[model samples]
Target: MLAEAAKSQFSRDHSDHLALVRAYEGWKKAEEESAVYDYCWKNFLSIQSLRAIDSLRKEFFSLLKDTGLIDGNPSICNSEGNDANLTRAVICYGMYPGICSVVHNERSFSLKTMEDGQVLLYSNSENARETKIPYPWLVFNEKIKVNSVFLRDSTACSDSTLILFGGSISKGDTDGHLKMLGGYLEFFMKPDVAEIYQTLKKELDELIQNKLLNPKVDMQAHRELLSAIRLLVSEDGCDGRFVFGHQILRPLEISALSTKPSLFSRTESGPGGDNSKSQLQTILTRAGYTVPMYKTKQLKNNKFQTTVEFNETQIMGQPCSNKKSAEKDAAAEAIQWLKGGAKESHEQVNHMSKLLKKSKKDHL
Candidate 1:
């Protein structure tokens, strides 16, 4: 929302959140009793909007004063939140689980979420058109699905921001391994490194809880803890990435599945051969889904098995003698499953089928 409001004042050179802070500071610096109109006009900002924001800011300060959360002066509170990195961390903290992973490849980058595997940011986001985002994560305020899933009002999040404030961190099975969002976000460190983070997090959590309980408590009293937290948040940089969902078949499992030759055919060539894969891809693409991807792996018996993935669905094919046959078999199975086979209901496909049928009938 503040994107356009801040752009003229702060230029699109920093994270979206920092732009707002810069714009507000610049506006305040330029504002005087009689010069507010000229300043807003010159910067292309709305004068009424600035007035409303000032009104709301004063109201919050008054409310905080009444609750004993702040003294008469507001500058003291500024000592903590005024730092840009801390401000970003606080935003990430409030927007926990509302995060996306930034994946960059040769040509472009994409965003992914836990629920919907692949997503995109709305065009308004500063990061939407970026080909390479330095950070591994983005904290977003909202998401909606129209033509496709879109994240809105997102700010790039550093490894430190998400690790320190994003979600509950859990100890993994191995030492120095940490997991967040039920293992979706993984943090790897030396054994001693994990201990340090856990300790700092505990102290920070305690300090926040104490401040919540005792409004009169001075947060500055824990200067050492805050300093350490700030140092980590700044210096650690974005050294990690969120875990994206994909599966590698275990060797033993693949061996067991490969042994069942009696129940399966060696290839999908009898009726559905090479053309099946293309047919499946066409159908899915026309239905507004990604073209299916085939993952082929060689087995111990020198045979290949393939898994075709699309729309977050995965279907494994019978083991075949070659990569080509394995992929064909995989696509055949996916096609059969989508046409309403034993794998269960294909609600999305079925819904699209009905719409297509209706359109044909109307034309007739």
Candidate 2:
């Protein structure tokens, strides 16, 4: 009803009515399109529309001042480059009614969402576009291409802490964060790492269909399968080292055959080690989720059995937090109490002491 009232109050004679409606529809569409891809192209349609609609919306809101529907003073929204970028990150990671931590990185930069409003920002330009000044409310940044990404809902946490770790700008980590908890976060155990395995199986089937491998041994088939995955998921964010979704590969070691194998050898060899997803699953397992690799079972052929484990500390990071805000609040409370002259006392002690003395005298 409130939305309807807001819509109804829009004026027909206003030159921007058409533009405002167009902008609203465009914003809605861009949001929907934005959710479709874990990673999007440099010039996707949604990016373009976001730029357009954002600019127009700012313009339309400005026009509101002349008409007096609102006070000449209009409410303003603040924007920070990092916050806007983090918002993009969350949407890329997705918020599918569950606890998730979204992670992303480039060749030299890495980042993750610690809190709810952080977004993923991308630019395909050789040098990323940088904006310094604040714009009119309608002004929107152009659609940018994402290099890499990860989005995950978190586990059921008693306390909301979006821990961040292992990202140093010098070592090339660009971490951002957000948190939601209790009633705000809904936990679901559906579509865990098992889905990733299923996806791999489908791709393997496709390779078989394309005559890329002999079914009996499948060495070449396996290689082809691995190559396909490397191509499809190798972008900065696509790799799972930071997100820790699943550990399908082994770490790179520099021995004669001790070197880390590519992602292909890792998944086919078994589900642990350098495989990033496997590590992620291990992290989830330690956190007490019933991940399948951690729930070991006998293999039918009996050639080999796999068990996955990771040191708790090796995981290195947790989600982000609102603790900064919480700290500020605590400090404020302390200050307020000090100003109000509140105090704690032991008044009951005086009466208890007198009673004790009388009782002692009677006993004597």
Candidate 3:
């Protein structure tokens, strides 16, 4: 499917929706329809699915024409359709709130959605075969659960695309911060940068609305805004990553924590007293990774089970009667592995502690 979508002999690094467009267009433009079966057989693609897609596409075009969304000449609508960055931005625009953070590692990467937490892409994806994607987020089509939850076809996207092309944005909990999806996704940038993105996004939305209303309207009038958008997405320095398990500490919350010295101490907190969850997150965070994620599921026996995940390690504790205790037990189980009960988690946290103490003494 990837090779077919890419239209390339060699495997490529692309997870964009336009690739799908280009592939389907290529199929339609093929001179010899006889080789269709051969192509499908060689590439492990299903001819039945392809035929359905072909039929659906024509119906879509007819519906659009009937609805006055487009005229017979698609040329006007496709003026910037080949612009890969803009196409991805458009996909993100239409697919708002379906975005997930892309955290790359040396050999592989992981995905985390706002609601689902840790996820994986199917092995067949071109993006899945690659160790890194040079973008901050992926606007996915959908997700499924087999052995584990997996994200289906997705497009790698930059921060600028999301910020300038996604849903309505709002101010965040702190200065120089912006948020979306009811504050599940947060962005921090210079205040001016935020303003620029918002300004450009507003103009972009208006231009689109105008074009939809008047298909033949001259879009060249907004060429400046178009140029700015093109420039931004192309040169985007993706200075962001997946911080999956982060939680903000409010002022009152901070004050309460400060009053309790042992709260930060593992020896004191130690997997009990609802502090296991906090301790698990703090240790992982101090180790320079995102906070650990906790997933809770209701069992058939009227019990709840929780799994705590971090650093690609997923540990599920014994089930409990309620969600809170299940999460706490899972966190405690993870803490056991992190804090030298098994290894790395505790050593790293202890290492961070030493660094903190050294810095404090040096200041004194």
Show the colliding residue pairs in model 1: none
On residues 146-246, what C-alpha lDDT tens digit does candidate 2 reach at each position? 45332211111111011111011111111121112321211111244333434554565465455433323434447765654433332223222222222
TM-score of 3: 0.61
- Which of candidates 1 and 2 reaches a greater lDDT? 1
What does the lDDT read for residue 56 in candidate 1? 89
Query: Any runs in candidate 3 off by more than 4 Å, and if so which?
Result: 1-11, 32-34, 213-217, 239-364
State candidate 1's TM-score.
Answer: 0.62
Model 3 Cα lDDT, one tens digit per residue, 1-364: 5655534542343664665665555555541666776666655556777788889978998898887777778788577776777777778877777888775543466777876777888776667766767666888888888878888778888778888888888876544567788766666566787788778888888888888888776777888998999899878765452122222111223233223222123333332233778767655543335667789899999999887766666677667899998887777666554433533545545533432232211110
TM-score of each: 0.62, 0.19, 0.61
* RMSD in order of candidates: 12.5, 28.4, 14.3
Candidate 1, residue 290: Cα displacement in angstroms equals: 16
Give lDDT: candidate 3, residue 39. 64
Off by over 4 Å in 2: 1-52, 59-364
Q: For each candidate in the order shown, give its overall lDDT on alpha carbons.
A: 0.66, 0.28, 0.65
